[model samples]
Target: MTAARLISVNVGQPRDVELNGEIKQTAIFKDPVPGRVKVVDHHVDGDRQADQVNHAGVHKAVYAYAREDLDFWAAELGREIEDGFVGENLTITGYDVSHAVVGERWRVGGVEFEVAQPRIPCWKLGVRAGDKSMTRRFELALRPGAYLRVVAEGEVGAGDTVEVLSRPEHGFTVADASRIFHRDRAEAARLLAVDELAPPLKQWARKRLGLELEEEGG
Candidate 1:
């Protein structure tokens, strides 16, 4: 396999954006930052999540998107896709973020991270894209990037190599998790057995399997 490397490291501060008729706080407009940046408790030193309810937490800490995926979208959108265009903290290349195993561990520079889950586009994504239909477009794109949890906080920067430390024996990937959450009960049943699956996704799978209610879901 070709080595994977960090293309860019990005972060953003919350900004007021006009959505529909009201102003809303969003941090989806991330820009690449030069030099090394520390990975703190749950995010990069200069990054902050605007909405905590659905974004930014231990399990959804560092978002990573593949540069190849961005290239695909750029061609589709008839424009150049910038690094961190979709709010990802790390823009990577060579490794497929969407296919990353859910429990896989990787090290970039001095930081260690675990694959946590796949991104689920929201209205904030549309706001960032400047298109009301972007959320739906992204969902259909099937290139949903992966979110990672920090295992060992340290610093990272552009050109840093992404090194895989270990991986679960099971083949449960971010794409499978995304599919289960979106619409596949059978797949959910199979993947729920993977002990290393992210807890939030496990809860969601249980709810999908009728073992819990939506209110009890993650």
Candidate 2:
């Protein structure tokens, strides 16, 4: 298979905006950055996450969306969706990010990242796109992007080569994680099998499988 490559490096700061008569703070609006940017252990430099409770952590240091997926959405939405429009830190090409397995390691430029989980579509996605139905559409499409944990922090830029260094044996793909996240109980076993999944995701899978409470009390 051809090597995946970074098509764009995007970043954004948190800002407040009005959504459905409520003032909400979000970092969903991102723009592509020029030149190389520092990839920190926790996040990309100049990037911010407004909802720390749900985003921007060591397990989700960088979010990546495939250019092909963007193209599909562009055709479906009847408008050109630019890179970073979906709040991704990296717009990538030549990889089926939605199908990437948890624990898969990717070396890009001088940095290394591990696939952590699939990005769960939130209301902010709809709010940013100016369509309340966008979140539902995104869910139905099942093209949710991937979030990566920084394994080795360094600098990266657009056009950087991305090579997969390893893949987990558990066979739990990001799409499987996304399905479990959306309450598809059938994927619980596969979700639980992935040891590299973030803690919150593991807890969620356990809860869905009726194991969390049992395990916690023990």
Candidate 3:
């Protein structure tokens, strides 16, 4: 297993939304993008269940750990190979994570979330990406990224070495789901059934799979 090098960490305000109804544009954390993690208090009103706080999808910040770090902990992170997910709030890169099929798990710092599904490209990332196409690029990548539901919630910080305890299921992975979820409605429905996905992703999976929506591949 090759480790992904930590590229850059960044964080920013909604640049559009208000915090707790207060009109604040900046976050408490500087260097918003941590070398390995990014903690923020943002908003996700555009997601499926935007009204719910947990469904906000932008709280608790996002930790963008490098995939390269996985190589070191495969042995020590004693958990089911499929049960690996360090506290990396978001596991991705210019890479794919949506296709990580059902039953596969990622354990990090005692935190675990199965490879549930891909994140729908939302306005939040669009702002973060700085390019309107950033979301488009994520969608095009198909493996938009990995969504994790906190299994054993614990305080995680940057510089943490997240571990990928298990390889993806056969013929299914985060990458595969990305392509299928957006392009093929049938497959999207399938992922929606997985229990590990966050609420927002679950809603997306159900809607896309239920409606069998058609998407024009970019």
lDDT of each: 0.89, 0.88, 0.41
Candidate number that wins on TM-score, 1 or 3? 1
Poorest stretch of ten by lDDT in candidate 1: 177-186
- Estimate the TM-score of every prediction: 0.94, 0.94, 0.52
- Give the per-residue lDDT digits (tens) of candidate 2, residues 156-217: 99999989999978778888888777758677777667789888788877777888575555
Prediction 2 TM-score vs. true? 0.94
Clashes of each: 0, 0, 26
What is every candidate's alpha-carbon RMSD to the true fold?
1.8, 2.7, 10.8
Instruction: Output the number of the lDDT-best candidate.
Output: 1
Candidate with more favorable, higher lDDT: 2 or 3: 2
- Off by more than 4 A, model 2: 213-218
**For residue 123, what is the lDDT in candidate 1?**
96
lDDT, model 2:
0.88
Across residues 1-218, which tens digit of lDDT does each residue of candidate 3 receive?
44432233333232334434555332212132333332223321111232234323432223333343332234433422111123233433322344455445555443444454445554443343334454565566453445544444443333344566666435455555566656775666655555544455456666665554544571
Inter-residue clash pairs, candidate 2: none
- Cα lDDT, model 2, residue 62: 95
